[model samples]
Target: MQSNQANDQWFQSAAARDIHLDQLKRVERFNGRAAMLGIVIGIITEGLTGAGIAHQIGLGALVDGYAACRTQFLPFCF
Candidate 1:
């Protein structure tokens, strides 16, 4: 009975750890996706639209990408 109780506590902690790891991975994937999206938008905006409008999407995408990356950047590296 005591061993079973201890096992339950370990499972709870492991579950919590898994959740944190999953969130970290998700944030990372989004960061990379956002960066690529921003670059593509910038190119299309300049190529088809014009420098001004292209820059608008480009800048917006860049900011979003940075924000996403910042979320996990430090923890990911260190």
Candidate 2:
């Protein structure tokens, strides 16, 4: 927006100023809550299944039975 070239002070100032600790705390708090909820859902699902959830889904379970052999095939390689 300047007529001539200028330094990037505006963007730098926007990045550096720290007026919002409470907002940051709220963001972190919500993130933690979401993660905890996910864990609880995972635990409940595990309880529903007779066998416990493995660290990783077993190879046999992931590929053929997973989304008709198309979707989860690539993720299993990782």
**Best model per TM-score:** 1
Candidate 1 has which clashing residue pairs, if any? none
Error of model 1, residue 63, in angstroms: 15
**Which lDDT tens digits does candidate 2 get at residues 1-78?**
573324477665666665366678889999999999978876787788744445224654654455555565454543
How does candidate 1 score on lDDT?
0.77
lDDT by residue (1-78, candidate 1, tens digit) is 999999999999999999999999999999999999988877887787656552474575666556677887544422
- lDDT of all predictions, in order shown? 0.77, 0.63
Q: Which stretches of candidate 1 lie over 4 Å from their true place?
A: 1-3, 52-78
* Model 1 clash tally, residue pairs: 0
Location of the lowest summed lDDT over 10 successive residues in candidate 2: 51-60
Q: Which sections of candidate 2 miss by over 4 Å?
A: 1-18, 51-78
On the 0 to 100 scale, the lDDT of residue 46 in model 1 is: 73
